[model samples]
Target chain A: MNSRKCLAFEIVANPAAVDALCARAETWLIEGGLGTESFPVAMLLRESLNNSMLHGSGGDPTAQIRCHLQRGRKWLKITVEDDGPGFDWATRLECRADIENCHGRGLEIYRLYADAVDFNRRGNRVSLRRRIAEVMTS
Target chain B: MTTVQVQKNDATVTLEGALTVALAQELRPQLQKAVAEGVSSVVFDLGRADVVDSSGIGLLIATHNSLKTKGGRLRVANASPEIMNLFKAMRLDRHFSVEGRQA
Candidate 1:
């Protein structure tokens, strides 16, 4: 059986911290033997984590957001948790129905890129899972 | 990791390299200024863009919206297959006038 490995990170809810988070996630994906899935994974992670910090936490630099990346033989799991009050994801979904709209595409991007997405009761935490081979082929 | 070179006409911006969050931030102000100055018929040349995330897409949409409000148009060119797939998944092709669609 192939061993599964997981990595975690804590970041401030500032937009400037996005680069660092993405860099670390890329490194993790590369080192974990999922290099082919790196691009899409990075994109999905950027959107999810950015939304958590930017919208959920209202870009509060003082707030903390936790991120986790897990790699298995055939699956990859990502989770992002924020400390801000959550909103109605259903309403957000409706707002993104307009493709020409400038805003409200973050979560939609997450849905498009990730194989599966889940939000907690408060909607402040998100979990994304993707099949490694499926992502690579896509 | 994006480099923007404005054409002599000031109507075309050639963006090179990845359009990540940090790079998108850097390009946002320059584009906003161009749109504000009444630069119409802008072309965002993405032939060399290797990666683009939500931030990059958001910036593109904002630029398109800004241009349209000024009676101008925004066109994207030379997007890679991977990028095209991303745009297709997000239905961004309908929002931005991409040069070609191959996906």
Candidate 2:
């Protein structure tokens, strides 16, 4: 467990910071022999982080977010925490097919792309996991 | 991050780049201007778009609904495999006119 490298960091709750986060995560994953997993991993990171920065913290630049990433031979784990009131993660996780609806699709994207999506009881924190081997095979 | 290049073939607008949250806000003005002139058909050329996140999807849907109110249609063309899969996975393909280049 300790043998595998883990990365943890924080970013201000600002959309502009997402690109750097994605770049850092993608580079880390690629360096870990998970380059093929970069797209989904990056996308997942962007989606969750976007939600955290925008919706969770209401785009408050002063608010900070905690991001943790851990990679193993077969799995990758991500958790994003924001300093804002949480939402009903259970209800919002459903995939809304209404293309006319302008919002509420972020969680659905998570469910579709990630192997599992979970949130803290407070809902301000989100956890995402992906099966690296499964993503590569698929 | 994303640029919505308007070819303006009367009403079509081509979009290229990574359509994520970082760019969605910047694109709204262009899209609004395009729709303002009562453009009947709006086409999003996503062939060069490497990524489309939920914000992108929302923008597309909003643009679709806006065009619909004017009796116009929105078409998404040349989406990458990843974007196409996103459309299908979210069942947005059924709602938007998504046509893969290979399809």
Candidate 3:
């Protein structure tokens, strides 16, 4: 029997709304037995959602951001899509170690936390897969 | 919610909630004020903070830069394990003191 769980939702491209979405998603993941995986999942959700809102939609309130989450026993997959002109994601994937800069660390966070990060050719969509530890059932 | 306490040349800022872009925008000015007031050291008490995003990381770095220009230092105390790992992954601990929450 397959016990995978999935969630799909959309939100307006607003920063505050993004925060609320992350919180809600975190709770959902925890309730679904993700345990420690919930934290990184929520963090990654925030990063990707913010990127979509700020860069993709240019903070346009009318733009809609779509998110999907799928959780299995050993992995969680997250996807975020924005309706905006995509950028050259290839140029921005390099993780920089510069601590003095206040920006450009979002991509690095994705790289460090997610086991696999993928972007569509348009760069308006990002999918992240993170490996999770098996939950021990008592 | 955020609170700032200053004593002598040091300041302690306790933050509760996710340290994302919105909170970063709200707290930036207050932190800059602390730095401008000649506080030589700033310690962020994030015991109540559950999560942090990239902008939150940017805020910390920016605050560190501001304090450094004035010969001050920045330290993060009581960060959750997940947050601590994020900071360490980004090598932020190399630039400032980052401590994990006590068990």
Q: Which candidate is the best by lDDT?
A: 3
- Per-prediction TM-score: 0.82, 0.86, 0.91
lDDT of 3 by residue, A1-138 (tens): 223378788999988788778877877777776767777788789899988888899768889999998877788899999988985789878757477999988888888889999999998999999998876543
**Local distance difference test scores for all models:** 0.75, 0.78, 0.86
Q: Which is better, 1 or 3, measured by DockQ? A: 3
lDDT of residue A75 for candidate 3: 85
Q: Residue by residue across A1-138, what tens digits does model 1's lDDT show?
A: 222378888888776676687777777777666787777887888887777776778757778889988876688899989887875765564455466666666777766777888888888888899887633322
For B32-79, candidate 1 gives per-residue lDDT tens digits of 987786677778778777667777887888888888788878888888
**Model 2: per-residue lDDT, tens digit, B65-94?**
888888878898898887788788777777
The local lDDT score (0 to 100) that residue B70 gets in candidate 2 is: 84
Better of 1 and 2 by TM-score: 2
Per-residue error at B76 for model 1, in Å?
Answer: 1.7
Sort all candidates by DockQ, best to worst: 3, 2, 1
Considering only N, C-alpha and C atoms within 3 Å, which residue pairs clash in candidate 2? Answer: none
Deviating ranges (above 4 Å) for candidate 1: A1-4, A134-138, B1-9, B21-26, B99-103
Model 3: how far residue A18 lies from native, Å: 1.4
